[model samples]
Target: MLTKKSLIGLTALGALALNAVPAMAQVTAGSQEVHAYVGETFGDDLTDRRISGRTPELDDDVTYGLRYGYNFTDAWGLELSLGQTNSAVTGLPGRDIDLDLTTFDVDAVYHFNPSGRFVPYVVAGLGYASADLDRPIIGAVNGGSVRIGDDNGFTANAGVGAKYFVTDKVSLRLDARYRYLDKVVDRFDDSLNTFETTFGVGFHF
Candidate 1:
C-alpha cells in the first residue's frame, strides 16, 4: 500500500540511481592531452586588384604546431594551439612576395566514441592570423610601391579528425580543417579561405 508521500520518495530514489551510472569512455574526465604536429597549408589567392590588376596566388607550404587540451567530460574538451608557416605569393612580374604566417586558436572538441580505441571527433573554433608580406609591389593602378600594415585579424575554422590509440596514453592523430580569414589585410579582399591537414603524435595523461 503506497501512500502519496511514499510514491514521491520512490521517484526521487530512482532518479538518484540513474545519476550514479558512469559514462563509458576510455579517457576519463579531467584528463589532459598534448600533441606535436606537422602539416601543410594549401594554396589560396588574394584579390590584390592593386598589385597587377590580377589576383596573386599563394603556394602550398609547411606548417608545424603544438596543441594542449583538457577533457571536461568523456566526450567534450577544450583545446588551444600555436603554429607557424612559410609560403610565397607568385605570378607577380620580376619578383615574388615571401609570406611569413603565425596562428593561434582556441577550440571546442566533441568525441563521438570515447570508449573505443579509435575515436573520431569534430572541432570548431576561432583563431588569429598574422601575415607578413615582403616585396616591392608594382601596383598597376597606384603605380608605386604599396605600403601597408602587416595582415592580422580573426579567423573561424571547423574540421573533423580521428585518433588511433596504440596504448592508453599514446595515440596517432590526423586532422583536416577549412579556415576563413576575415579580411586580415584591409587592403585585400574582404575574406580569404584556406585548407590545412596535419598528422602527428599525441599523449593523454
Candidate 2:
C-alpha cells in the first residue's frame, strides 16, 4: 500500500512524465553530454521551538555547485550534483548563528525539447545532506540562544529548468527546485522543505 507521502511524490512525478512525452519524440538515439555549473541555494522558513505560534527563519544566501550528466536518449538523462551554502540564521532574537548546508544528489531528468535551442526539463532526485549550526560570536552568556546540533539526513527534490544552447558545447541553464528534507537535523522531529533557484552556464562535451 502506498503511504500518503509516497502518493504525493508519485503524483508530482507523473505530471512531469506527461509533459516530457512530446519532447521524447524529438530525441536522438545515443545522445550524450557532460556539463558543469554553479548556482545558489535558498532555504525555507524553519520552525525550531515555536514561540507564540511563530517560527524562526533562515536567511537565503549564495551557493555554488557543479553537475555532470549523460544522456542515454534525447528525453532521458542521469545527473549527479554537489552544492553548498552558508546562510545566516535569522528571526531568533538576540542570537548570532550561521548555518552551513551541503548537498549531494543523483537525479533523473526528462528533457522536453532536446533538439531545440531552448530545452525544458523536469528533474527528481534523492540527496544526502549535512547541516551545521554554529554561534558566530563567542559569549559567556548567550541569552536563550537556540542551538542546533550538527546532523545529516536524506532528502528529495523536484524542479523544472531550462537550458538555452548557445553553441554545440555551451549553454545557459536556469532552474527552480523545491527540496524536502527528512530529519532536517537531529533535533527537529519534522521534515523541512525549501525552495531554491539558480542560474548558471554549462559546458557540454
lDDT of 1 by residue, 71-100 (tens): 999899999999777777766655778877
**How much does candidate 2 score in TM-score?**
0.74
Weakest lDDT window of 10 consecutive positions for candidate 1: 1-10
Candidate RMSDs in order: 16.8, 11.4
The residue ranges of model 2 lying beyond 4 angstroms of the native Cα positions read 1-38, 51-54, 136-147
lDDT of 2 by residue, 1-205 (tens): 2223433443454344334423212334465555444455666665545533345556677665678878888789898988777776666555647887888999999999688878999999998988777853222222443445556889899999997665655566778899887754454335778878876566565
Local distance difference test, candidate 1: 0.74
